[model samples]
Target: MSLTRSQVESIAHLARLDISEAELPVYADSLSKILSFVEQLSAADTSSVEPMAHPLDGESQRLRADEVSETDRHEKYQANAPSVTDALYLVPRVIE
Candidate 1:
């Protein structure tokens, strides 16, 4: 469950992070501890456990009624818009 300096460097490169040489040892030790935790988690017996949608219960999360009950002030909302066309926000074109 130990991580090397080179492995840490590779992980940093893949994550787009700039890690200095002095920071490599610190990162390697931290990564090694995480790997050890994963190894410990792998030792768990999950064969008898049923898959659950939630930690407390498998029931779906509560949600508000789908029917619209409130009205929005569209004119006030659009007042602060930087650019608007036909009651809609105008965004910069990203594609040709």
Candidate 2:
């Protein structure tokens, strides 16, 4: 699929990118090639393929045990705050 200069400009605007006149054609060609590659991938058959959670079978990701490791110091910390209510810090409202 070939992309025109105007399409490239629209893409740039949507992506919040600043593209110069000299780079517009280059970007358009590159984006067109990417879209073509995706189209080719879509044409491949994968009806028998099994979905995988991870590449390695029987190998699960290890995670640290969830446990409380610190003592509560809310009263000590709240003393330093300019304003706090019910263990929550109070901030000035900037919005109307």
What is the per-residue lDDT of model 1 for residues 1-96, given as tens digits with 9 covering 90 to 100? 999999999999999999999999999998899889888777888989886666767365778889998798878899999998888899989798
Q: Taking the tens digit of each residue's C-alpha lDDT, what string does model 2 give over 1-96?
A: 989999999989999999999999999899999988788866768889887779888777877679987799999989999999999999988698
User: Which stretches of candidate 1 lie above 4 Å from their native place?
Assistant: 48-96
Top model by TM-score, which number? 1
Error of 1 at 5 (Å): 0.8
lDDT top scorer: 2
Model 2 residue runs over 4 Å out of place are 45-96
* Count of backbone clashes, every candidate in sequence: 0, 0
Q: Which residue pairs clash in candidate 1?
A: none
Model 2, 85: alpha-carbon shift in Å?
27
